[model samples]
Target: MADPFGMTELTEILRTSIGLDADVRFDGELAETEFAELGYDSLAMIELASQVQRRYGVRITDEAVLDQMRSPREAVDFVNSLLAGKVA
Candidate 1:
């Protein structure tokens, strides 16, 4: 199995996907911070999902991206769960 999907990796992908960078460090606050509040939109979230699928070979739907993976913490947990066979 691959390494666990984590916030640091998500942060990097998100930064590139949105074409901007912020000081959203990985912390309790950041974990719960919504992408919209970070100045990122659904399209950017879609791009992040695309990058994750390309790099990890795991596909998560845009609906899932919008509904479930609203924040970096949620994304990390969701991807790790999928990678762990916890979600089919």
Candidate 2:
């Protein structure tokens, strides 16, 4: 079976999804605190989620989920759960 998650893909997704500069390092292990530390706000979360939804074809209707995401890993897990048919 394919790897449940692709690190390179995830990194690329995050880099584009968050509008990060190409030179920025996106290691795919950012924590929620790191997001806050980096100044990610409510609007940024919405935009990021929207970008992820469009790119990954995963719908994130619950805004709370985005609000609850404290890290890139959590966001990936949430999207993976939705893709696995765990949320509908």
Candidate 3:
């Protein structure tokens, strides 16, 4: 099945959640970019996760998985996997 959420939409969601400056042009393609590089700390990740849960109805309760999500692409892939029933 195709991803319910496209990468662009996910990127926008991530950008909104991260609250980047207007002038700060997020390339948004650096899928491997670490959250720390984007000035996101653990709290930010938690907030992002909460946002994802609220928006996608997918609860990501695993701390390890959360910790492993280093970029918006990773989060998006995880969410898509959940939506596809590829993850439990």
| Angstrom error at residue 49, model 3 | 0.6
Best by lDDT, which number? 1
Candidate scoring better on lDDT of 1 and 3:
1
Q: Write the per-residue lDDT of candidate 1 for residues 16-46, one digit (tens) a residue.
A: 7666556657688978988788778888888
Candidate that would win on TM-score: 1
Clashing pairs in 2: 32-70
Per model, state how many residue pairs clash: 0, 1, 0
| Candidate 2 worst ten-residue window by lDDT | 25-34
- Which regions of candidate 3 are displaced past 4 Å? 23-29, 62-65, 86-88
Tell me how far the alpha carbon of residue 46 in candidate 2 is from the true structure, in angstroms, after superposition: 0.8
Query: What TM-score, computed on C-alpha atoms, does each candidate reach?
Result: 0.83, 0.63, 0.72
Candidate 2 lDDT by residue in tens digits, 1-88: 5535444555676576655656655454443334566677767777767766776677776565556555666666666777688434
Evaluated at residue 60, the lDDT of candidate 3 is 80
Candidate 1 yields a Cα-based lDDT of 0.80
Candidate order by TM-score, highest to lowest? 1, 3, 2
lDDT of each: 0.80, 0.61, 0.68
In candidate 1, list every pair of residues with a backbone clash. none
Q: What is candidate 3's lDDT per residue for 36-75, written digit by digit as tens?
A: 8877788878877777778878778759445656776676
By TM-score, the better pick of 2 and 3 is 3
